[model samples]
Every structure is written in structure tokens, then in C-alpha cells.
Target: MNTTISKIHPKEIKKVTLGAGAISINEIIAVSRYDAEVLFSQDYRERVNLSRSVIEKFLDEERVIYGVTTGFGSNVTETISTEDAEVLQKNIIRSHAVSVGEPLEKEVVRAIQFMILVNLGNGFSGVKLATLELLRSLLNHQIIPFAPGEGSVAYLAIEAHMALVLMGEGKAWYNGELIPGNEALEKAGLQPVSLGCKEGLSLINGSTSVTAFASLALYNSIQAAKTADIAGAMSLEALKGTIKAFDPRIHSVKRHEEQAITARNIVKMLERSEIVEKYKDYRVQDALSLRCIPQAHGAVKKVLKDAEFTICNEMNSTSDNPIIIPEDQGDALMVGNFDGTFVGIYADTMAIAMANLAKVSERRLDRLVNYHVSELPNFLVAKPGLNNGYMIPQYTAAGLLNEIRVLVHPATVDNTPTSANQEDVVSFAYFAAKKAYQISKKLEYILGLELMAAVQALDFHQPLKPSPVSQKVYELIRSVVPTVEEDRYFYPDIQFITNLIHEGEILNTVELIIGKLDW
Candidate 1:
């Protein structure tokens, strides 16, 4: 009874200030998904101005800097005069903007633009202050660049598309219409600036695009991981399974932090359940799906934690090439900081972990509806044979599970060289993060089906009630969907529960009953 949790409504947030490395995923979601205005502090603007001064001085002195004086990739040996520095920046934006596929989601485009803006605000990219402001204008005015969803090995293609929009070239989304970037700028009452010094290289040279997607993906996965636990607890009560396996003593011996956390959450959720107390069924021990909820979901939690660390660090740290050392003053250190190995590896790990979570959820859904295993009414329907009940949902879950399983193949393993072998051994972290995003959606649907079936089974428990947490979750579902006395178009019922899971309504209701679920 001593918990204090503060929640921010995304829609109500009006502004997000950026500087250095302090932005969290919530802030990103507010600006990207909720149209929150982006602002930079005076100190942030000064830092950018100072960094731009360094590059301008270098340009004045004709000091040779990688990606500034020389051509990009294999042509770095070809140097450019100060007169051509601006043109060099422009050409890179045009040349690298080769992403091909359907345009990225509007929120994703905003997130990408925001990430770019934040990185430049960090003052290590050697971009002009005006260029950074232009990026901010695109974000604030809601003119999203039409960045494609494909062709990125390490955020290059997508970011290039974003940079093109800044140059008044690429297509943009403005006023609910996809228009040319120049037109979008005109309507937004903004003008594009010509790239100068290292602006072009700086814009497309970093891993912001992949990091942006990874950051958002990590946020969503963490949400799904917590919701998965709630679904497991609800399934446990509905199936009349004991909480013996979640005993602290059993988990204390292993000392796996995530597993212990998950066990504690389950224990708290099923604290005073009548269903669990009267659960001496056919078998003394339940299947692994019921018995190892903590262990399985705990593994997923660990992966998500690792991903959060990697992504947040990437968000704060500058992932640019030839990073402008503000402290060192005019020294552009050329290094391979742009390598996305950490993001790629952790994203793959998260994908595999999520696939495992979904696999167990599918089996648990099997236990809820298939009467041979659940001992509940067949399909949890009043007339199983007449209506077909909740039979096809499990099949849908199975199909989604199969897709998730196939996506677990690590994208970092196969590296095809790009930029003419100058960029050999690329980390396809974008695809890995993208795959995790896809898996999270699929897993949500699978868990949604499980939640729907579990709530239906709880209806049969009747006089015997679920725990406080599960009861609240059941009521939240019933608020959106009536009890499935007979299967009326079950897809809508499944979708309603899925929306609850995705929108955090069910998780919020359950957490209110029993403090916050384990991370």
C-alpha cells in the first residue's frame, strides 16, 4: 500500500525539450506519435553553434577531414575545395536517399526526424545550427518525410530519405496529404536550408534511424512483456492451476533476477484467489506453460532490459562518423562509432526471447479452449459443435506463432557489404529491430486470444471467483466485450482484447489492483 506511480498522458503533453542525452522513450513517443512540439534549450543551441564554428574554421583553414573534405566511401581520397563543401553535402543527401518500399509509418518518420534533431543538438555532428533548426521545424510542423521501410543496412537508406526532405527534395506528409517536400515546407511556412561543411555527412552518417526504431520497439516490447505476465496469471486462475511453482523459495535458490521478479508478480496477482485454493485437479503438476510462466517470461524480461540499456545509451551517445570533439575544439575524430553491433545483437536477442514467449502463450491458449486439456466446456462455449466456439482463434495464434518463429533468425548474422566494400560487415540492426517490432504485435495478438479464452473459461468458474487482479482484468475485458456465452463474430472480441493489451488499458487496470507488474 506504499506505492507511488506517476503516469503521463501522451495526448496531453504539449512540448518536449531536447539537449545532450536525457530524452527517454516516453518523450520520443510524445513527440513522434502524439505531435508534441519539440524545443531546444539555449545551452543546447549554444553547443550546436560552438560545434558548427569548429567545422567552419576547419573549412576556412582547408583542413582535411574525413567525409568533409574528401568524397564518401571508397572515394574518400578525392578532396574537395571549400567552395564545393556545400555541394558535397547536398550530393550525399541525394545519392544515399535510395530507400525502397512502402513509406514508413507517420509516427516512425517523426521519431526518425526527432532522433536526428536530438543527435545534432548533442553538438558532435558538425551540422549548422540552422540545419538542426530545419529538422526541428519538420518535426514541429508535422511534415513527415516519406522514408521507406526497406533498404537500410544500418539506418542509411531511411535517414538519407529524411535528410532529402530537409533539403526540400523528398516527399513529405503534410495536412494528411503526401506532397513534395518543397510544397510541404511552403504550406508549413518553412524554408529548407542548403547543407554546409559536414552537414550532409553528419545527417546521414549516424545510426539515428535504427536507434529511433529500436528505442520505440524496446518500449513496446517491455509493455508486451509485462502484459504477457498478466495474461499468464489470468490463465493460471482460469485453468485452476496452483501458484506453488511461483513460490519464493523455489526462485531464491536459482537467483535469476528476472525469474524472481516474475514469480513475485504472479504471487502478488494470485494472492487470495478462491480458484487457486480449490485447484486439486487431475494432475498434481500442471504443464510447463502453467508451471514455468516466470521462467519463460523472465527470460524475455532480461532480453528487454538489455535492449533498453543498449538503446538508451545509443540515444544519448553520438553514433556519428568523424565526431566533432566539442571539448577538444576543432578536432574531428574519425572512428567507427557508427557500427550498430550492440543494437543489432540485442535486437536479435529480443526477437528470439519474444518468439519464445509467444510459443508458450500459444500453448496456454491451447490449454484454455481445448477441453481435453482445460477440462472446461468444449471451446469454452455453451454449444461447442453448433457454433464452432473459440476454435479458430487458437489456429490464428498458431499461425502468428509460426511467423514469429521464422523471424527469430538473427539479422546480424548475415552481413552483405555496401558502399563498395568500404562499409563491409554492416550490422543490419534496423531489420533486427523491425523484426522485434513485428513479433511484439504478433505476440500481442496471441496473448489477446489467450486473454479472451481465459476470461471465457473464468465465466464457467461462476461462484468461484478469480483473484483481485484477474477479476479486474476480466471486468475490463467485459467492459469492452460481453461474456462469450456463444461465439458471435469472435474476431471482434479478440481484437477488443488485443486493443486493451496494446493500449495499456488492461495492464493499467490490473496494475492498479496489484501494484505495477515486474519489468
Candidate 2:
């Protein structure tokens, strides 16, 4: 229910022009998170019209066009006259709008709208220019469709729910209030659009939902990855873990760029730390949780990079079926571009990578709170038994990690054929991307708990100051979440620090002091 548009001030609104070139992941983030306004280039308008002209010409000749003249899916053999084309389009939206569960966040719905523009703006999906304009108007006016969060195999159901809002037939959120779609559009000074030919099919087809979820998840995963390094560094310093394991020579010989980058990032964060310098040879080497920071976190970075590449490519590409080949006089070709296999596989891999990242952070959190291994006070509190501080927080991290583990099971591996098995072998990419998105959130909370515990453990070291970067990060967290003196309501503290991670406050604070962490 929290709308990104409410957070945007007039002066801060950014404009992203589509159809001029490939859409970048950052541009999607801009529109989704920052409430950036979207615009279409002149070239995009021409392309859309060209493709639409093809559809209109086919309709005039009464040529057979899937989803336009013929029925959809298993009903492809059923032919419809041109007079019934509009009814077929409207019927598809009505029948396919069957997604159920909690409504998705406004940001996600906004991202879906933006992806629709990118997918259809290339003159492939034969949607009318006016239809695309109506969608743009909805986004600019902050009228978000009330899309259900579940019940999607490869994006049809969710997208169909969203498309209903275009016809003023489903629910929508206008100015933070859920209301009838028609009223929402009326309040925004926009009228409902009339479906024409393939407009309805174009609106709901393709992997827009999967790509949108994956795009947002990729952005958050990258943020969590950076924060993991900072959290690991703080824990290592608190445990008085040796820094020799982070030596550049050791990582350079490993022959992985991300591994070396992570090693260097840790060294940079712990630079000139009295805690690390004084205990440089503490017990020869630290635990694997501390010593393998670079390798573990680096492997996550590699997965994140691959996911970014795949998801970004999906954002720019069209996934429409019976795609209009503009060069061949609008020859419609039935293809499997709508299959979300590429994005689904990468998104599943992203969840697995993030699970491993959280697992190691949970291990480090254990080292921070366990008195026997940490050498600090039990639970990092002065009076251990009476205070019972930071003990249950580790349990919370473990629970979150377990949830992420269960979610990492690839959704792509399980296929359920729909449309009477005529559409067999689905991608299930929507759930895959959705699972990855959920895991990113759990990962943030786990990292947040580790950060909170690390800061508390640092207090035990007293006057031995942490590195400048680590100290700044500690202070940044302390600004919102005060140090725990005894047992208290930890949920508020946990939630506050989690917000810090989600908002990039910790990563930004560290980066400002040490430049950007290596990708």
C-alpha cells in the first residue's frame, strides 16, 4: 500500500525516455523506486504505429491472426469475424484476471507498467499507441493497478489482473485508497481504454511480471551483497579475527575477480584498525566464517552479476507471441519468446546465492554473540544471565536463513501445463522471481542483525578504535538504533537497522569513506 509516488517531490521527479535505446536496470529502478516519469521517443511512436498498421491491415483483409481473429491457446482453431475482435480482446482480459492473494506492493505494480512499455514499445506486439499512452498516463498520474501477489505460472494471471485496470474493469489504487478502477481513472482525469485487436493479448502476454520481479530483486541483492562485506568486516574486527586471510596475494592466486575484489574491500574497510592491528596474529587464523569472507561473498557477487545481465536483457526484449514482424509486411510469427526460462533460471540462481550469503552472515552473528568463541561478554552484554541480550537475535537470523533456504528451491524445475495442456511446459518464472525477491528481504534482515551484533561487540573492545570506515558505519547505525544495554524490545531495533540496509544507508556511508566497493 506504500506508494513510491507519495515519496517523490515535484522538483525531484526524473524523466526516463523509452524506445530511444535499450532500457537499463537503473532506469527501471528510477521509475519503480524514485517515481520517475516515463516518456516515449518519436521513434517509438512511429514503430508502434507501424506495427499497429499491420494489425489493422490484417483485420481489413480478414486474415487469420492468433489472439486477434482466432481464439487463444487451445481455442486457436476457432475463428472470429472482425466485428468480434474487440469482444475477444475484452473477454481475454476478463477471463485471465484470476490472480488471487495479497495485493502486490505499489512499487512492483509500477515496475510492471514500466516493463510493459519497454516490451511493447519496440513495435513487436501490435498494441495501439493510445493503449501505451493510457498505461503511461496511469503511471504518471500515480494510478497503480491492484495486482494480486500470487497465482501466476508464467505471468499471465498477474498481468491479466493489471490489464483489467486499463479497461476500468478491475481494482486500482488512487492516492493511497483502493477503489473501483473506473473511478480511479476518472479521478486521475483519464478515461478507460477500449481494447482493439491484439491490445488485450499484448498487455498480458510475455514475461513482464517475471522480469519486473527479477529486476527489483537484482537491485536489492546487489545492495545486500555490498552490506554483507561491511557486516563481515565489522564482525571480523569485533572477534579480533586476523586480517592475514584477506591478504591480496592469497585472493589473487584464487583466479576469481570477485574473490580478489571482496578481499581488497575487507582490507580497505579494516585499514588502520587498532583492533585488527593489535590482534593481527590472534590464534594464527580465524574461523571459516571470518576467514572465508572474500570467497563466500565473492561467489554471491558472481551470481548477482549474471542475474543482472540476464534480467536487464529481458527488460529490453519483447516477449510477445504471434509477434508482428514489421519488416515482412507485418507477418505474425508464433514464437516462444514469452517463455521466461532465461530470467526464471537466473532468478532461481540468485535466490540460492543470497541464501549462502545469509548463511555465512548468520555464522558470523553466532561468533559475535557466543561468549566462548567471541571472547567478549556472553551475548555481548555486561551482565550475561540477567540481560539475555543479542541471544535471541541470532535465533531470528537462523529462522530467516531457513526460510530463504526453503525458498531457493527452483520454481523452474516444476512445470504445470495450463490451457488444457495445449500450452504445455510452462516456465513458472513468475514464482521463481517472486521467491528471489522474498529471499532478498530476508537476507537484508539477517545482515542487519549481524550489523547490530557487530556494533555491540565493538563496544567491548573499548578504546581500541575500529577502522575509520567501520567506525563511520557503526555510527550511522547508532544514529537510528542505540546500543542495547540490556534485554529490551529488539524488534524495533531490528526493523530500524533493516530499513537502514534496505535504504542503502550503511552501504552509502561506507562507500563515501572508501570510494565504491568493487562490483
lDDT accuracy of residue 67 in candidate 2: 91
Clashes of 2: 0
TM-score for candidate 1: 0.96
Candidate 1: residue 91 lDDT (0-100): 91
lDDT of 2 by residue, 1-519 (tens): 111112222225498899777777667878887889999999999999999998899899998889989999999999989999999999999999888999999889999999999999989888999999999999999998988888999877898888898999799999989999999999999989999999999899999999999988988898899899999999999999999999898987888899999999999999999999999987788899999999999999998987887787778788998899888666888888888999999999999999999999999999999988989999988898889999999999989998999999999999788989998898999999999999999999999999999999998898999999989988988887787887889898899999988877898888889988887
Which regions in candidate 2 have their CA more than 4 angstroms from the true location? 1-13
Backbone atom clashes (below 3 Å) for every candidate = 0, 0
Total clashes in model 1, counting residue pairs 3 or more apart in sequence or in different chains:
0
Q: For residue 446, give model 2's deviation from the true position in Å.
A: 0.3
Candidate 2 collision pairs:
none
User: Which segments of model 1 are wrong by more than 4 Å?
Assistant: 1-13, 280-282
Q: Pick the candidate with the highest TM-score.
A: 2
